[model samples]
Target: MSPEPQATLELQRTLVLVLDLCGTFAFAVSGATAAVRRHLDIFGVLVVSFAASTFGGISRDVLIGATPPAAIEDWRYLAVAIAAGVVTFFWSPLVERLRNPVRLLDAVGLAFFAVAGTEKALAFGLSPLMAALMGMLTGIGGGMARDVLLADVPVVLRADLYAVAALVGAGIVVGGHLLGLPVVATAVAGGLACFALRLLALRRGWRLPVAGGAPPPDGDA
Candidate 1:
């Protein structure tokens, strides 16, 4: 690759690490909160928390060519998640009672990871559609894994904006790239799009249109 392209790739990798750490921590907190709510044992909580936060990123990386993934590389990603889990284990009561904080932090993780994943895919010269899909995976994969662990329906399958927000964020990044926008600017715009969409979904209960033209539940059919 050209030097410019190489530099951009490096920058993308660095940003992925930074954002991954934040996302990992946030995911861990979410899992820990769940475990605490269920009154799980300490060992189970730690394992679930660590796995919930990192498995998605690991899965994304492995699919896109990063074998073993950064989550398993350098140790910091897992460390942060594990630490957060351990901390939350001791602070179970506080984390469990505060639903807003869990949602807020999970949103934070989703926004950053979506942008980071999309940017990384673009950096690797992937197609826009694939890039967006990867971004959504990065944002929601962990939570899906988390839900599966807890034996609940995946959040992405629910009537919520989680996956939609990730897709919008990634779409912005892909569009900006197609227009030759700078990487950082594209990432910022994409991340903001995800954040805004998530917050809006939370505030207004936005959901993806249903299949088969399901009639509105408000008697508007």
Candidate 2:
């Protein structure tokens, strides 16, 4: 590879790393915020934060055959998550003052992770469609895990446009790549597409249609 191509590749790698870490931090804050609202203990808050932020990336890495996973190999990821947890624990009142902070913060995490996950998947030689699916999973998986831990239905299943937003974002990245866009441009476009769609859904009450005409009996009749 020539000097110019090598430099471009290095720049792309750096952008991906920065975006991935940003997603981790955003998810951590979102998780900690949820825990605070649930009145969880400090340890619980930290655990939720760490799991919410890292597991998606870890799962993606594992599926892509990235041994040990970045979450396991990278100390910064855990450090950022713990820091976010501590901040949310001490700043609960301020966070609560924000209207629906959990939903908003979760949207941010979802967008970032969607884009980052797609890029990482592509980098690891996955097909574009598979990359998009992985991206959607990465965006929503942590939240699902968090909800399960809280004994609540996952937002992706309950909320309208949740996973849809992720899929749109991943699609944007894949499309941009196919069109030969710069890595930074593709990342920004994809992240913004996801974030904007999610926020719009929240504001406009957009939702996917559910199954109907089904009334199951309780406990075998």
Candidate 3:
């Protein structure tokens, strides 16, 4: 590869790694918060954190035939999740003080994971459409697992535009990649797309219309 292209590739790799770790941390926080709300013990909190942060990546890797899963192969991923859980555990009161902390953190994680997943799928030679779906799965899988563990309905199933935001973010990355945009540029664009849409939905109560003749339940209900 030419020097410019090589540099871009390196930049993309670095950005993906950074964003992946950040997403892990964000998801860990979300999980830990949920555990705390449920009055789970510290161990349970950490377990939830690890599951929420890594299971999504694990699911993506497994589906793509990446054996052993990066979450289990790489020690850093576990460490990040544990660290996030420990921090959140000790600072539960502070975190609870924040307005809608779990949702906000989950939104950040969702955006980053969507970009990371799409990039990884593309790297694994998947077509753009499949890669986008992988991205959406990576964005929501962990939260689904966390909710299941807690015996609560998954947020992705009920939240306004949750999966839609993930899909849009992945689409942006795929579209940008096809247009020959740098990986870092595409990731930034995609992450911003997901993040902005999530925050906007939260702020303005934006939601997809539900099944006909049945009034949609309130999100906060």
Candidate 4:
């Protein structure tokens, strides 16, 4: 039976919050790790970590009309990011040793952000397309910002499963909404699907194949 709409929504919100926290932690650690590798000062590491963790959610919240945004409103997210960064300074090598696992954690963060962002958009009475777009934005926004700050090309713009996986996950949420699935189940499907797709892509090199077999002519033929 279809769950009460209100109850379903509440559950979805809780799930989203949990996912958001995880994303914050993962991204913060990633940025902090990079800062350590660069021999950045503690202040710089914390700044980058805080930015990495809270920026995406803050941007998502602002777009969805959560005024002041969660990151600015609560302060907990930034505190968490700061704490993680401090710990990372001591354990940076451990993280570097398991770089692949660290990346998988980032993928998990991306999935959670996408799924939760889509659900929030839907709840805010957005059209499905807009909702999905929001999901994509939330999933990739922080990564894009993080890379730009580091002077690297954004991960989402590259030939990777990053944004595409998020898109597919958001699609699941939209489809499930049409099918009248309960919010919890729908969220699980959407988030897990996105996570799986991203991880699988990482495992198998599932990237957008390059277009056009013919090389560009060096000179006019």
Candidate closest to the true structure, highest TM-score: 3
- Tell me how far candidate 4 lies from the true structure as C-alpha RMSD in angstroms: 3.7
Per-residue accuracy of model 1 over 101-140 as CA lDDT, tens digit each: 7888888899888988887777667898998999888888
Q: Score each candidate by Cα lDDT.
A: 0.83, 0.85, 0.89, 0.81
Clashes of 2: 0
Query: Which has the higher lDDT value, candidate number 1 or candidate number 4?
Result: 1
**TM-scores of the models, in the given order?**
0.89, 0.89, 0.91, 0.88
**Model 3 root mean square deviation, Cα atoms:** 2.8
lDDT of 2: 0.85
lDDT of 3 at 165: 95
Shift of residue 29 alpha carbon in model 4, Å = 1.4
Rank by lDDT, descending?
3, 2, 1, 4
Which runs in model 2 stand beyond 4 Å of their true positions?
1-4, 100-102, 213-221
Model 3 steric clash pairs: none
What clash pairs does model 4 have? none
lDDT of 3 by residue, 4-88 (tens): 4667767766777788898999999988989989999999999999999998899999999988988899899999999999998
Per-residue error at 122 for model 1, in Å? 2.3
What is the TM-score of candidate 2? 0.89
State how far residue 42 of model 1 sits from its true place (Å): 1.3
Off by over 4 Å in 3: 1-7, 100-102, 214-221
lDDT of 1: 0.83
- The local lDDT score (0 to 100) that residue 22 gets in candidate 2 is 81
